[model samples]
Target: MNKHLLADRVKALTPSSTLAITAKAKELKAQGVDVIGLGAGEPDFNTPDHIIEAAYESMKAGETKYTPAAGTADLKKAVSQKFEKDQHIAYSPDEIFVGSGAKHVLYCLFQAILNEADEVIIPTPYWVSYPEQVKLAGGTPVYVEGKESNHYKITADQLRAAATEKTKAIIINSPSNPTGMIYSKEELSSLAEVCVENNILMVSDEIYEKLTYGEEKHISIASISEEFKKQTIIVNGVSKSHSMTGWRIGYAAGEKAIIKAMTNLASHSTSNPTTTAQFGALAAYTGTQQPVEEMRAAFEGRLNQVFDSLNAIQGFRCLKPQGAFYLFPNVKEAAVSCGFTTVDEFAADLLEKANVAVIPGSGFGSDDNIRLSYATDLKSFKEAIKRIAAYVNEHSSASD
Candidate 1:
C-alpha cells in the first residue's frame, strides 16, 4: 500500500476524464436515475452484422490463435488496399503495424520513438490520451493553444514555434476530438511543410476519418505528398467508423523502420491484436461501405436536430462541428451566468440536478468549454439538451 512501491510513471498518470464521467453516468443509471450521458466518444451503434459474421466465421474455422505481432498478412493486405482506394496512397504490409486498438498503437509508437526529455507538441483541446501517452513514454508534452477563433486548429507558425532541438513529434488530429473540426488541405500542406523542414515526425490521428458530415471531407497529412508521407505515421481503426470499439483492432502506417520498431514492441508486450477481431476489421474494410455511411448520416441528423437548441441555451456559444460527433461549447459565460464559479462545478451540478452528464473541458486542457457527444440516439440527445437549457434558465443570475 506504500506510495513508493509504485513506479513513478504509474504515479504520474492522469486517468481519462471521459471514462470517469461515463462511469458516473452508469452508476447513476444503476440507481434508477434517468441520467442521459453525453460523455461517451464511441458510436452507439452495434458493430455491423457482416463484420460480426466475419469474426464468427473465423472462430469456426479455428483461426483463434495469435497473429503476427503487427497483424495477419491478409488483413494487412486489405488495409494496404484500403489506403490506396481511400487516400490514393500506397502502403506495403511492412509499412503497417496493427495493435489491439488505435489507442494502443499510438502508445507503442511513443514507446518506440521517444527518449527521456524528448518533446511532443500537442495542441490544446486535444484528445485526453495524447498528453498522458506522451508522458508515459518519458516524453514531455509541449502545449500550444488552438484558439477557438481558428476553429480549434493550430497554425503552421504555431507548429514551427513549438518545435525545438529536442522535439521528436507533433500530432495532428483532423476532424479533431473535442471540437470536431477538420483541417483543410491547404492547412495541412502548411503544417506538413513545417514538419518536413524541421525533420519532425507528424503523428496523424485519423480515427474519425469516416465520420465527417456535410461537404467536409477528412484528409490525411500523409496523402499530401511523398515527402509528407515519409514524415507521417497514421493512427486509425474501426472503433468509431465501423462501431467496433469493443473489437479492439487498430493500426498504424508509416516508415518501415518505425513500423518495425512498433511491431517488435507489440511482440513483447501485446503479442498480437486479437485474431478474430483482425478478421472482423478485414471484413469492415473489404465489405459493403453502406453501414459506415448510414452511421454518419444518422450522426449528422442528430447534430442538425439539437445544435440550435444547444446554442440557444443562455450564455452558450458553440461552433457547428464539421466532423465527429462531439459539440465543444465554451460554457464559461454560461457557468458564470448560472451562479457557478467554474465549468467543472457547473458540470457537476448539471449531472446532479439536470441529470445530464457532459464532460468538462478541463480534462482536455481547455477549462472554459465542455464536450457533449451526439453519438447517442436523437431522442436522448434532444432531451439532454433540453434539460441543460432548462437548468441554465432556472439558475441564471444575469438579471441580478
Candidate 2:
C-alpha cells in the first residue's frame, strides 16, 4: 500500500494520548514492573450478573440476529423509559438510537451534523476525543477556557464569545472527565439559553452521570424546559452505569430529525451495533438499580479519600470533584518545585522512576495539571499516592 495514497484527513488525525500512555504502562507491567496505573477512566467492577444473564438468555433464544440499524425496538423503548425514569426527560423510541458505545454514538452524531468550515465550541480541559471527533467530521473546535478558579467550567458569557456564524454545536460533559465537576441547574440553564439564542445544538455527554459523589446529583439540561429539550441531544451508555464497558453499548436520544440522520448513517457504516451487546444494554436500562448504587457508593468512598491525599502533597492543588472517579490536580507548582521542565516530563519521570502512571495535562488541553484515576482499589491508590508524594518531596528544589 502506498502511504501517500492515504486520505489527508486520516493522516492528520491525532491519536489518543491516554490510550497510548495506557498501552505503555501495560507493556511495563507485562515485564513484571510494579507499575501502579491510574490512567483508565472506566470502573473496575464487573458487569452486573443479571445483565450478563439476560444477554445469555437472549442468545439462547436466538436473539443474535442483526437488530434495527438504530437498535432493537425493545432496547430503544427501554432506553426511552430509562431516560424518563432516571432523568425525568421524556422521549419516544423514534428519538432514540443505540450504537456501539457512547464514543461511536458521538462520532456518528458529528458526522451527521458537521460540514467543512463549521465550528463546535468545546470547553478546555475537555475529554481528549471531543476535538478530534469534531475535526474528523470536518469541523473546527473553538476552545473556551473553564478557569481553574471557576471549578473548570466556563460561564455563559465565555460561551457566547466563542459562538460564530459558522458555529454548529457545543459539547457539554457533566461529571466531566479530567475535572469531575458538574454544572449546576442554574449554570446549565444559562448555557442552554446561549445555545438557544445562537440556535446551536447542545451535545450532552452524560456517561458519568451515575458516578458522582457526595450531595452531587446529575441533572440533564434538556429537562430545564421544552425549549431546552428541543436544543439538546443526550449521549449516554450502559458502559459506566452497569460496569459493562466491554459489552459495547451506548445510545443517543434527541430530536427525531437528528436521530433519523444518525440511524441512516449508522445503517451504512456499522449496519448495527453489536447484536449481543444491544441485548445486554437492554437488560442494563431495565435491570435492578442495586448494582449501580453499590458501584456508585464504592466510587464515592474512593473519591473523598483520594481527594484528601492529593491535596496533601506540597504545592499540589486539587479540587474535591463532585462526580466521576478521577482527580485532576494542578501540579504545576509541584512539578516546578521538583525541578522538572514541564508536567509531561515530570509525568514521564514519575512513570519510569516511581513506577506510577498518570496522564499529563497537555493531552486534555491544559499543561499545568495531571489526571489520576481512582478507579483502582483503595489500597493500590494509596500506594500510588504515597509514592508520588515521596518522589515530589525528595526532588524538591527548595530542599536542595
Highest lDDT: give the candidate number. 1
**Which runs of model 2 end up more than 4 angstroms from their true locations?**
1-3
Q: What is the C-alpha lDDT of each candidate?
A: 0.95, 0.92
Residue 385 of model 2, lDDT score = 96
* Predicted candidate 1 versus true structure: per-residue lDDT over 1-400, tens digit per residue: 9868999998899999999999999999999999999999999999999999999999999999988999999999999999999999999999999999999999999999999999999999899999999999999999999999999999999998889999999999988999999999999999999988998999999999998988879999999899999999999999999999999999999999999999999999999999999999999999998999999999999999899999988899999999999999999999999988899999999999999999999999999999999999999998999899889988989745
lDDT of 2 at 72: 92
lDDT of 2 by residue, 95-186 (tens): 99899899999999999999999999999889999999999999999999999999999999999989999999999999899899999999
Candidate 1: residue pairs that collide: none
Q: Model 2 misses residue 58 by how many Å?
A: 1.3
Candidate 2: give its CA RMSD in angstroms: 1.0
Model 1 global lDDT (CA atoms, 0 to 1): 0.95
Lowest summed-lDDT stretch of 10 residues in model 2? 301-310
lDDT of 2: 0.92
Output the number of the TM-score-best candidate.
1
Candidate 1 regions exceeding 4 Å error are: none
